[model samples]
Target: MSDTLLTDLHVKYIQNLGKNKDDLTYHMTAHLRMNAVYWGLTALCVMKHKDALDAEETIEYVMSCWDDEAGGFGAHPGHDAHILSTLSAVQVLAIHEALARIDVTRVVNFILGLQHPSGVFAGDQFGETDTRFLYCAVSALSLLGAIDRLDRERTVTYLASCRNFDGGFGRVAGAESHAAQVWVCTAALAILDRLDVIDVPTLGWWLAERQLPNGGLNGRPEKLEDVCYSYWVLSSMAILNKLTWIDSAALTRFILSAQDSEDGGISDRPGDMVDVFHTLFGVAGLSLLGYPGLDDLDPVYCMPASLIERMGLKKGWKALPRRL
Candidate 1:
């Protein structure tokens, strides 16, 4: 029932994440440990609390997840390398400006090796090819300043294939157009400098249709509205410079209502348990919405705009002006 973001409590909530090893959920989500760190870190940064987590320790944890054998990072220590975790690792380090700690050359090769001839990428040595993994590879490479080494035409060809008649993208060619997949695909296309491949006007209308009567957005048709789409859907619209297409005030209230006012973190919807994933997206979405007191988020990178701009990787996306 809250209309305002509980920023201070959310900060404390993020600060306390992974502190309770006795919790079963900690062990259950080991595969997402690296990404959780990235999520938590990026959330902190957008809230203008980048130093809320100890920098040395944060960067150290990122390094510990590095898989020496694969030259890329893993979800947790001793896990195998994967494109998703690799991108999270790159993002974490790049945000902290500590990319020099890892061997970029090998990491680049590890990522490059995962791409199939068809331009889609596999998640890891195992096989799960999707546009999600494709975006991960492109994003990780762009952050490393090695995207030029990627086969652009071949890569964008796969992206073009993922486009559906509705002007939205899917996890794979012919798959249903999902909001999450749309962000990854749209952001990846922006990183590749390939907006021309997208049918923006049609996609914009389709994305606008995601907003429900309650002001929250759902992934696709008939799905329940969730807080995470605050980032997924809003970010995709922001990248297309269509932020004005959605009702920001109502959507912002929807995001704030999903927050755990007393406990800090946000959930998929109000009355649900909050987690770092939704917490990050909720905060990121607010930033994009120009909520007063929040720092700007670069919708494409999902990081602080300053950090992205400093790396010379800023794109031409637009966010709403901050409230007075």
Candidate 2:
């Protein structure tokens, strides 16, 4: 399960954007906006391979995605500002140690503006609310050292309402449980020191059930496996203090098999396209499994060594108890 291939592919993604190009402005197409996830992935990969990246230039590109008008960021220039992208943008900048380049006060205000009266967060000004946006809201605030900007009590109550009868979390209240949403909601609670509010054991059991015979994890019961869920489910279980409940060895095999040896990244499945999104998560999954080549990732934030240090938050298994 050596990740040489995966790292190489990620480097290629970074390279494809061209040298000295602003990542925030470099979109695959003119109509498609630069996305926060892309910048986040770029920042993570840059941190992972600092010696290999033009760090300062890359950070500048990530910062360009910030949309000062709407009090949040967009995926790229000309895109609507959104909580999800704003979170990624802030986290990426933090990871790059470039938080100084951002207007912290305005960014904080932007995140605060997205919070509705009910404690639910809209993804953007359009009022599309979801648990995913809630995760972004919390995570962005955490990265900014601005968690105080959020109404913690109301936010936690809203997150609790998204919990489904299946013991997993959903995108919104009364929606069906989903693995990605479960990760977002669980991580939000962990970051807020409210993990005990959920039925940990039941959620852990449901996450464990997502594992397929092929060694990959799926989003929900009976769904096909995807590489992205490897991070979603594994990180959630890790935050819950229940990684032992899942088959780590089998999942590792599936993740490694998805690597495109020639291209240098892992795909969603064994023969699929390799992209930055899966590349970061693939490494994150390996880190969760205690893979030798990588360092331990924060189960809640999914950030790397440097950015976590910059935040100076509590770390390791002990931090888990504090959340409880």
Candidate No. with top TM-score = 1
Per-residue lDDT of 1-324 in model 1, one digit per residue for the tens?
A: 688888899999999997998999999999999999999999998888889999899889889988998888999999988999999999999888999998999999999999999889899888799999999999999999999999999899998988989889999888989999999999999999899999999999999999999999999989899999999999999999999999999999899999988889999998999999999999999999999999999998888898889889999999999997
TM-score for each candidate, following the candidate numbering: 0.99, 0.88
lDDT of 2 by residue, 1-324 (tens): 343335655666555645435665444542333442443354344336644656676577666766767766677666677776677777667666778888888888877888898889988778999988888888888888888878999999999888887789898899999999999998899889898788987998999999988889999887899998988999888877788887887887888888878756667888887765677677678777776545556767777644576577643421112110
- lDDT of all predictions, in order shown? 0.92, 0.74
Error of 1 at 2 (Å): 1.8
Give candidate 2 misplaced runs (Cα > 4 Å): 1-6, 17-47, 315-324
Model 2: colliding residue pairs: 9-264, 34-75, 34-76, 35-75, 71-110
Residue ranges of candidate 1 with Cα displaced over 4 Å: none
Find the number of clashing residue pairs for candidate 1: 0
Candidate 1 residue pairs in clash (backbone atoms < 3 Å): none
